[model samples]
Target: MKVGVISDTHGLLRPEALAALEGCALIVHAGDIGKPEVLEALAALAPLRVVRGNNDLALLWAQGLPDVDRFEVQGWQVLLVHDLADVPAHLDQGVQWVITGHSHKPLIERREGCLYLNPGSAGPRRFSLPVTLALIEVGADALVPEIVPLLAANPLKATSR
Candidate 1:
């Protein structure tokens, strides 16, 4: 199964992000999805799972949203949330992948056979962080991840001056 992981979309969903997420069986929005339209747009592309972030509290629609989410994909346990720091300790549910976004920095790390992924800020450009997202192929056994930067994914943009 192909899964697209994205976060910190503070109301902006760029075409580059959409294009990169194409063909994904599921899309995980970690948090900071500024508007309902952003969710709608992602839902249009694929089945979407989302969590509420700090910035999302003001919106009425986010009042009932959960702070954390858990899912099983391709026999691997996946946990989704906005901030990694909020992940509970000492309570184990066999989680294999921890997907969270808050710092606006793309990251991929593996420890003790579990993967920690942050797709970064796919929304409006933030500070100096690159606009990026992640694509993961969860097969019968292995989980392969690819971090795709918006600039490289945007086909219309020129790479050279």
Candidate 2:
């Protein structure tokens, strides 16, 4: 299963970001969505799993969003949260992957037995940070991750994984 992971859109869903997410079987948004239309746009692409961000707390449209979420995808146990700091001190043993946003820095790492991923900020450029998202290929035996940069020199073209 191919899953597109994105976060911190902050209301700007760049065409490049959307294009990078194409062909994904599922989409996960970590937070700071900025507007209802962002969710609408993402949902239109594929089944979406999302959590509310700190910035979304004051917005009425985001009131119903959960602070965190946990579920199974392609037989993998996954946990989603907007900020890593808020993650429970005792994470569930069954969770093999932890997805988080807020810092807008793309990351993929493994610690203990769990994989931690942050798809970064696909939104407006923040300082000198690269605008990016991520893709995860879940298979029967392993999970593969790829980071896609949205504002590369070519723009809209994703690096081949």
TM-score winner among the candidates?
A: 2
Candidate 1: TM-score? 0.91
Q: Which stretches of candidate 2 lie over 4 Å from their true place?
A: 153-161
* lDDT per residue as tens, model 2, 4-113: 99999999999998898999999999999999999999999999999999999999999999999999988888999999898777788888889999999888888677
TM-score for all predictions? 0.91, 0.93
Inter-residue clash pairs, candidate 1: none
Model 1, 1-161: lDDT tens per residue? 88999999999999989999999999999999999999999999999899989899899988888899998898988888899898776336688888999999888887676788888889888898788988888887778877789875432211100
Give per-model CA RMSD. Answer: 5.4, 3.3
Cα-lDDT of candidate 2: 0.89
Candidate that scores best on lDDT: 2
lDDT values for all models = 0.85, 0.89
True-vs-predicted CA distance for residue 70, candidate 1, Å: 0.6
